[model samples]
Target chain A: MKIRGYDKENEEIKLAMTPMIDIVFQLLVFFIMTYKVTTMEGDYNIRMPSAAAEPTLTEETLEDFLEVRLQADPETRFLQTIEVNYGADRQVWNRSAFPVRPAPGEDLTAAQLQQNRDSRKVFASLNQFVINIVGSGSSDPGSGSEIEAEIDADPALRYEDTVYSIEAISGYKDDQKRIVKLIEKIKFRDTTNQSP
Target chain B: MRFRRKRNEILEGDLTPMIDMTFQLIAFFMLVINFSEVELSEEINLPMSELARPPEEAPPFKITLNLKEDGSIKYYDQLIAGIDVIKPILVREIRQANSDGVATSDVVVIIRADMDARTGDVQRLMNKCKAEQLENFSLRVIERLR
Candidate 1:
């Protein structure tokens, strides 16, 4: 309880962390267990389309969400492509079974002819298949991150047909829908990137 | 007798205790310090959106949604086609978190979006949240706290 060299017998002494080693050991274990090794890879540039909508949910209601993909040509206003990004290496994309608008009187498969008769309907059916393909193993319907979307057709593709096409693929009136709550998210890839 | 007493006094105040304290302090800092965080790609220029909010602070169970300049989505740091598939994963992750009793509602979703991201794409992401009823998300921004 005193310094060895000091001649003052009244000198006050203290135990400097005589038991602090235990604290160090405990911290070592804590940090080790708290260590997280996330393997998130890739650096995809996702330019989020902004919105002025009011916020919902809070810091207390963590839930699921969907990542929607729209591949459209602004110049043509066509609903070129659609899909949803679930995770890395997984997707539910729309496949157009239309007969590529082939020249008149060309032989086509029954499935192809059926697809052309109802392009929008066919597109919708394909998308439905894509949606059902997911959560199949799950017993719950809400067990999915189902999204609703609105197609803001490009000026060229903004035709009633295009909108019809989009509506066919995604059932909803662009306002009332659940899950992905998708709508026409315009900002497409570089328009200037187009080959003139 | 005085000489013997002086010899006993010399044994007091050994440095072993102070050394132990120093080691403990070092261990504490090393444990709390997040050196792995430095590995995040600096090329990621996360844009700050007015629609963005702060992330949650808890046991660190969070989802990261990386945005591209062209309004595409990058999840788990990889390129995903769209939200159709992303939904199931989010549901599964949240359901799992909820089952573990680890406060799934406070799940900190870090939206790492690009500066040139489109307003529409941003809306789509938020819409995805509405579908699942999940909240407590934050838009990840690059800070100069270093």
Candidate 2:
């Protein structure tokens, strides 16, 4: 017999990949099946104490607050006008003043585009007017903090309009995409018994 | 003369690149997947706000109430018909919070109302929560992208 080491040819050992590949595919399928796309949401905070717990407000305290009145149409329940009262100063903005533009990439008919701008203009104007009175919070923090915005909306007004008004009064985003706080305190003037 | 047959040659295609790509895809999907989507309701179309910003951190104890256009309240997949019906639920929630050592004022009540819903209904819902001593409220809205 010759030497065993020199006589035997080298053999290749193969590892099984089918099982590993199957498991990896299964994991991929599971994740794909459970995948979901959700939109981003944010919140506007409000502290609403019950009417019974609310403290009595003096005339001076009432004068310090900014009153925003939202009036809606009786039949359509559409916002018709916005009346902003600051002490004795008052301004009224009509719903038809500002035209609502279609959202980015949104397709709309001419009639829909022409439809009353809802509360968009009044809110924008309200924001600007507030800025004029309170000054930019980014520049001066104390003034904005001291003022409270009391939203007095019509009972039948669409909730969306009320939200839009709140968003306008609360704050605005700067060019840098940072929020500049305006009026932090907001409350709804009880409209439970009020009619449209 | 003696003839020997040669064994058929085995050929294997390279699978390493394919496996690498598949793993990358799975990692991407895992990173982007949202598991907390159950709290959001698809039926209520939230109004968009340009100034609304997502909170830096979620509140510890929070309840979400979805208000539909027809004045129905959706709470954790349960459809409540009117505001009056939600009072009992609010009481139970407050009791649960109190048992957990959390004050009612500390708990946040998130309201996601439909764009077309009446403002009166939303106020009524808030009133019910107020009756339960839940003072903190959050009006949830979609972030309008510029």
Measured against the true two-chain complex, the DockQ scores of the candidates, in the order shown, are: 0.06, 0.65
Query: What lDDT score goes with residue B126 in model 2?
Result: 83
* lDDT digits (tens) for residues B14-52 of candidate 2: 899999998998898888788777777888999888877
Off by over 4 Å in 2: A1-15, A97-106, A109-119, A136-143, A175-177, A191-196, B1-11
Instruction: Give lDDT tens digits, candidate 2, residues A1-196.
Output: 7777764446655779889889989989989998876668999999887777887888978766899998988877777888999888899988773335578999766666555444366677988888876773236753356678898888788898888889888877778877777888898876545433
How many collisions per candidate? 45, 0
Residue-level lDDT of model 1, residues A1-196, one tens digit each, is 8778768666776666545657666766666676665432222112222232434535332122233445545543334555554333244444353333456788777776776665455455434644553434234443332332333323233222332343333322223333321222212222222222
How much of the real interface does each model capture, measured as fnat? 0.02, 0.82
Model 1 per-residue lDDT tens digits across residues B1-146: 67987777647557677666667666666766676464244445563222112323243466666656555566654676764457876787788778777675456555565544543454456557545655544445432121
TM-score of chain A of each: 0.32, 0.74
Best by DockQ: 2
Candidate number achieving the greatest TM-score relative to the actual structure: 2
Instruction: Give candidate 1's iRMS in Å, 1 decimal.
Output: 14.0
- Measured on C-alpha atoms, candidate 2 has an lDDT of 0.82
Tell the DockQ for candidate 1: 0.06
Q: Which regions of candidate 1 fall more than 4 Å away from where they truly are?
A: A1-196, B1-43, B48-56, B102-104, B144-146
